[model samples]
Target: MDKHELAAFLRNRRDRLQPEDVGLTSGPRRRTAGLRREEVAVLAHISTEYYVRLEQGRAPRPSAEVLAGIVGALRLTDAEADHVHLLAGTPLNHTGWHRRDVRPSVLALLERLPQTAGFVMSAAFEVLAWNDLAVALMEDFAARDPEARNLARRAFLTDSPEEGPLYGISDVTEFRQNVVRELRSAVARYPSDPAMTNLIDDLRDGSAEFARLWERNDVQPARMLTKTFRHPIVREITLNCDELHIDDGDQHLVLYSAAKGSPAAESLAFLDALGTESLNSRRR
Candidate 1:
């Protein structure tokens, strides 16, 4: 079990709750931000000393029944509770390195999409496979080393001194926040995978913003419906964003498309014709 991570998760959850949230009176003398640990132990029907030990990262792995009680006491969301379970090493058949290979069918589908920029992303945000349009619309992932294709690294760590945003996308803040949340989940699901662990360590050490967000312990990222990319050739191209989950591999097929006969559609078609060449020239 990841004692440190489990302890931190529990503390973070506890700090977000008010006493009244669990039907307790906010006594005038109470100075705690959220419900007190003693209060949580009482609600969970566990001894305060034991709960304190858990928070101190000194306790043994909690039983499933005890974890259920703590989950209720902390008022954790479904996602957060699942995360707690993962950190506590509760077996959910979720351990392993995240899948990187794109399915053959998914690869074929990328080639079949007309005027759509489609790509497959692994759980850790590596662009595993892409159509020509995706390369044009985004960057040419084929040219970069496999390690450099990680969107998390691109989002957080910039080689440029000026530190420009990725792809000049309009929602940099939202995108970075989502990246942190997804990586948090990824690390929990594959705690022992060096790829995931090293990536998390690198980002936390390299980027202060990433470190701050990581401490928040946020699991649910807001869903984005549309994305606007500021391409040098097209100026501005907005597309409807659709993320299809490939459950078997825990991968995502992301498609960027524009409405039929619209200006964005025309721009996409133009990019499709220009292909990866235009983007390469711009990079040069």
Candidate 2:
């Protein structure tokens, strides 16, 4: 919670990582472990002094490009990159997406974004309710399978021996990384939420990477995220995300948009079909 604590945590983690851990060749006469400040600077494409400023807490925030570079250089787990965002004060993650009572104005806005996939989420990262198109892209948003369980726990907790996952049973690294990053974005703002604490505990016990990411205590604000998703149903789709705060209520709405003439646009249309199915099933 405290900056000093954050700084210490960052330092401790940097020391724990080995050059080999990040695919760097271990040099002879390496008296200490982990990446040197200079090595991180070289990899991140920034000067050693600037990276030192970040590590020393002299720099209050880093630009998105710099943050990305730091992520690549430090091998900051998704959690760590997220932490950079939080420490930087980009914005609050909450968009009041799950509030039961939302102003008509906000709801109107959410409804108007027909070309984009959108939803309102709680501070808890609960997929309260998403638009027709949004549901199609994020399959989990469409799933009425369970409450209290989100993608993070589902992806990391379920084992191959159990119900089969689309990504196969073998240890999946990238999926784990995405989930960790997603969770890290939420963790920074609402650390005290018991639900989150429990979620992290389950993740820690379930995967080594999850445990490592959690231990770093990186807090990051999720904003304007542009990510690619490989949906089992839709193939690979890339979209730009925008999280908008509902000024009146605690809820917030997030929308994913693709270019007008792109494959992602087609995917958005497919999502509309899926949302119809979801509504129809409920009717039945």
Candidate 3:
């Protein structure tokens, strides 16, 4: 996982940059991630051969300064930039993983607002954990088997298209693009995760649609996206889905709450009724 993560992070970091973004021209047709090897080398003030070696996993180790240059040239985010340094194995003064059993403070604050529903998901798109309000508001997770999660894995599977319907989104193309990008982001973080690699392999081999999208190598940071979903019991509701790139690393907690007494609230009420009915039926 160590070397693999380094490679994945490098791959994702490079693919996300654009020629125009780095003040270069995308004049000619080329097949590669974001910036070409030569372009990135030029930007980072290094030799193209050196950069290629890094990407190909031939370079033994990268210095902090070198990692910084690469991150700067790529215009990576604070999180993405941190990942670059981590991948380089240039340990910073202090580094560690998410603290155990500490629910995101945002979850507590959100719990106070009982009407609002939200859940924090890992960057891997696993429902790392969610709040009760979140379960109540989000249909799929309400009775979700703890074992069944991971947004990317489910997206590529044929048996569980129900998850897509849970999002209530109809545009399969747009959804696939977002899921792929998100998964790529996680891949760099959890390079050894068998589930992540399995999802990629299955998608590539199982569906031609997945193969076509996989080849594009387009990476975009999905932020503050307002998506609409129609729950089975809720009828119709719109949510302002904001993704928080938890400063802690490839971890995130998504908050979904309604804006006052609106259609969303009405929908939530309906959903609650449905959940109650399902629970009661089982008890009987």
User: Against the correct fold, how does model 3 do in TM-score?
Assistant: 0.55
Model 2 lDDT tens row, 1-284:
24554466567767876786555787898888787888877766778888787778776565565555555555554456567557665532331112233445666776788688777765444555666666555544554543432546556566654334532313345545645666676555445444566777777887776788767765543344665766556667778867787644345687889888888888877766666676345434
What lDDT, from 0 to 1, does candidate 2 have?
Answer: 0.61
Clashing pairs in 1: none
- Name the lDDT value of residue 14 in candidate 2: 75
Better of 1 and 2 by lDDT: 1
Error of 2 at 178 (Å): 7.1
C-alpha RMSD (angstroms) for model 2: 19.0
lDDT of 3 by residue, 1-284 (tens): 25667767777778887786665788767766478888888766678898888878777787665665566566666677677677677864122221212244755665665555666666556675565546555544645553356565556554565454435644445776787776665566545444556667877887677677777776675454666665544545677676666664456767666676778766665554556547335434
Ranking by lDDT: 1, 3, 2
Candidate 3 pairs with clashing backbones: 15-34, 120-253
CA RMSD of each candidate after superposition = 17.0, 19.0, 15.4
Off by over 4 Å in 1: 1-93, 159-163
Q: Which regions of candidate 3 deviate over 4 angstroms?
A: 1-110, 140-147, 160-164, 193-195, 222-224, 269-284
By lDDT, the best candidate is 1
By the TM-score metric, which is better: model 1 or model 3? 1
